[model samples]
Target: MPNLGKLIVHERMRRGIGPEPFADACGISRQTLYRIETGECEPSLPSLRKIARVLHVSPGKLLDLGA
Candidate 1:
């Protein structure tokens, strides 16, 4: 696998958004976002959409296997 979680985190960082603030904006806890970024859990479509909104990125970018 190409580490989807890292891609998410990397994109967030690239966009200058923090996990806590982004997750809060997404209505999810910071810990949960952290887990997603850490590859501890996979996010569902809705969650991915929320995260994409928070990160100011497209859902495809967030879920891109190539980062």
Candidate 2:
């Protein structure tokens, strides 16, 4: 499986976006984002879509990174 959290972190950081504002932009709590990023939880499809939208990448692109 793709390390979704790491992908998210990588993309966010690549864009020079910070955690707090990124979570805010995604409409999720920072704690929830943290959990997802830490692999403590998997994000739902909706959350994945939100994350992808923010990252300016397709959700499939993120998933494909692991393939």
RMSD of each: 2.3, 1.9
- Estimate the TM-score for candidate 1: 0.80
lDDT score of residue 23 within candidate 1: 86
Worst 10 residues of 1 by lDDT: 58-67
Give me the displacement of residue 17 in model 2, in angstroms.
0.5
Best candidate, lDDT-wise? Answer: 2
lDDT of 1 by residue, 1-67 (tens): 2577887778778888777777888888888888888888888889888877877778877666333
The residue pairs in collision within model 2 are none
Which stretch of 10 consecutive residues in model 2 shows the poorest summed lDDT? Answer: 58-67
Q: Would you estimate the TM-scores of all the predictions?
A: 0.80, 0.90
Predicted candidate 2 versus true structure: per-residue lDDT over 1-67, tens digit per residue? 4478888889999999999999999999999999998889888899889999999999987776532
Please give the distance, in angstroms, between residue 65's alpha carbon in candidate 1 and its true position after superposition. Answer: 6.4
lDDT agreement of model 2 with the native: 0.88
Off by over 4 Å in 2: 65-67
